[model samples]
Target: MTIYVLIAVMTLALVLLGSSVRVITQFERGVVFRFGRVRPGTRGPGLALIAPVADRLQKVNMQIITQPVPAQDGITRDNVTVRVDAVLYYRVVDPVRVAVDVQDYGSAVLQVAQASLRSIIGKSELDDLLSNRERLNQGLELMIDNPAVGWGVHIDRVEIKDVALPESMKRSMSRQAEAERERRSRVITADGELQASRKLAEAAEVMAEHPAALQLRLLQTVVEVAAEKNSTLVLPFPVELLRFLERATPPETTTAASTAATAPSESAPPTAPARTNGAVPAGRAVYPAAPDAAAVAHAVAER
Candidate 1:
């Protein structure tokens, strides 16, 4: 019976020894504690032996952890009611503190992240959140990081997943954006109109200088209208031709022209001259009581 009891005691000791032996994986770290107090440092990923009941070890995974912060509702600095949700990425830089410092680091970080989100939302304006998102995200990571560091959680990144705005506020913002776009559109259209008018003025000056571009423009217009299939095309003649003709004409006729006018009238009375000669000859017959043809012929030959 004593031999059987010795065998049972040996069996119990082997089981206890086996129980004290722990194996840690490569991705895990073990924080050792002695009598309810954590040791100064951590343990290994390989085989480790601990005195049962006196030594306690808590294993922590060293992988990067992702924690989601709950949605937080707060009023912005601009008095806008906003609901914001965020995501946090963290990893345990110090495994000992992770096991010893906080009761539950994950829960603590989540709560702190929610609070930090609220605080940031309260501090930032609505436009600041919309326009300066990177700044806000950095600020959030900074604010949440300082406290999380003590909990053995090193915050790598913080992201604002979504920001929920009130329906009324969203509509107001939409209208504001639309109005801004419209204002820009109107300014651009006005600028285009100004440019076009300036170009027209420049072209007018060119036409005034060359006096030919106007004809080209008119010709182009006629071409444009002619392409419309059977449409009547009204052609515009240049006013420069008429102006040139006006400039070339004289106001009065010269003396040479007046003399040339009198020569034609002088030669036009041949019939009258003949009639006067015949009458005179007839009258001379009456006066010829003392004259004959021989006498007239001798007088003509001597004259």
Candidate 2:
């Protein structure tokens, strides 16, 4: 009877020992409380012993956690109402503080993040929040991280997900952007005009220094106009024509032989060149004081 009683007592003690010992996972740490007081530190991932009925173990994951915050509608500094949402990355650094200092660390971090977002939005303009999101996220993380230290949570990062704007504001922004583009285009065109006028003034000063350059420029202009296949090309001349006055008495002044000797011989009268007609008229012919007979003959042959 004594051996049987001793065997029963030993079996009961072994069962209690097995039940009090816990094996922590690789990614987890055990926070042990002995008689309502937390242990010195976290227990290892392999094996941990706790006093039966007096010690309790709470498992705390050491891995990083991602928590998404819902959209928050708040008024900006510019008095514009907008919806804003963000995500937060947090991790538990100290399990003892998390168990003793806070009731729920995860909920505490989330609530702190939500309040930080609103505080940031209240100080920023709608445009700044919409355009400069990275700045806002950093500010949110800094603000939340400071408050979350007491709760044993470390804020890794904060991310602004979306910002919803009113339709009327969107239309206004588009119109403003279009107007800015138009203003820039007008400024560019005005600059070009100013540059062109300055160049023309400089050219005139240069031409005044050399009168012959003016004549050459006029010829260049004529050539350029002709290149466009214009209906007419203008040719300007400013030379005088001096010819001898004719009298009817010239027939009686000399004998036939003398007249023949004085008069020049003419084999034939040269014909004028016929201009080649194209789709557009090349130009009208303006006569000089005297046309070179050889030139006329050559032109006729070439034409």
Candidate 3:
């Protein structure tokens, strides 16, 4: 009977020892509640001992937690509808407060993040939401951190994951971008044309000062066109050469036979003789003045 009682006592002690021991991982912290009240300080990693009947040990994770907030739909300040979602990075800074001050710090942080995101969306314009996300992220972190600080949770960072705009808005943005590109193209083309016109005007001045340059340019153009090996080649005749010919050649006298050939037909009425020295001469006939040889040759060449 003595041996049985000793065996029973040993079993009970082993069970109590096992129940009182708690293992805390390196990434976790142990919080104790004694008699329904939290302990003053937290226990660091490793083993912890507590009374089985009078104390409770709760392990709190100390590592950073990544939480993804769901998408929130809201209207922006510019009266544009949008949907935005984000990710949150945070961790517990004070385990004692985290365990006592908040019932569930993770859930609390998530709720605050969602609310803050919606508030930011409502206060920002569509342009800012799409382009100025860094500023919006900082503002969002401050908003979430304000309430999280009280719960002993520190918000490390907040990031805007994605912003969803309507299809119509997307098309409008595409059109705006296209129009901007077209405007730049037109401006550039106009600038190029203006530069070309200025350069051409300068070249014309140079060519006018040196007439030989014009002849040389014409010959160069002909050479380039001839290199193409085409069947036909057209050459330009310079106006200066024609004017030089006309100036060098003298007028020709009209022959009586040619004048008879050019004279009016007999059916035409005859006019009075032309006056000489400001007086009409008797027994003298008036014939039309002969045409200029250069003019007649030019007219014949044109026909």
Hey, what RMSD does candidate 1 come out at?
17.3
Question: Highest lDDT: which candidate?
Answer: 3
lDDT per residue for candidate 3 within 268-299, as digits (tens), equals 99887666797647776676654455675576
Q: Give the local distance difference test score of model 1.
A: 0.83
Error of 2 at 65 (Å): 2.1
The parts of candidate 3 lying over 4 Å away from their true place are 228-303
Model 1 residue 147 distance off true place after TM-score fit, in angstroms: 2.5
Assess every candidate by TM-score: 0.73, 0.67, 0.78
Best-fitting candidate, scored by TM-score: 3
lDDT per residue, candidate 1, 1-303, as tens digits? Answer: 999999999999999998799999998989888899887777778998888778988899899999888899999998999999999998889998888779898889888899899999999999887778899999999999999988888899999888899999999999999999999999999999999999999999999998677878877878877886657755343345445544544334654586687665655664543456446554444532323344444554575
Candidate 1 runs further than 4 Å off: 1-10, 230-303
lDDT score for residue 239 of model 1: 47
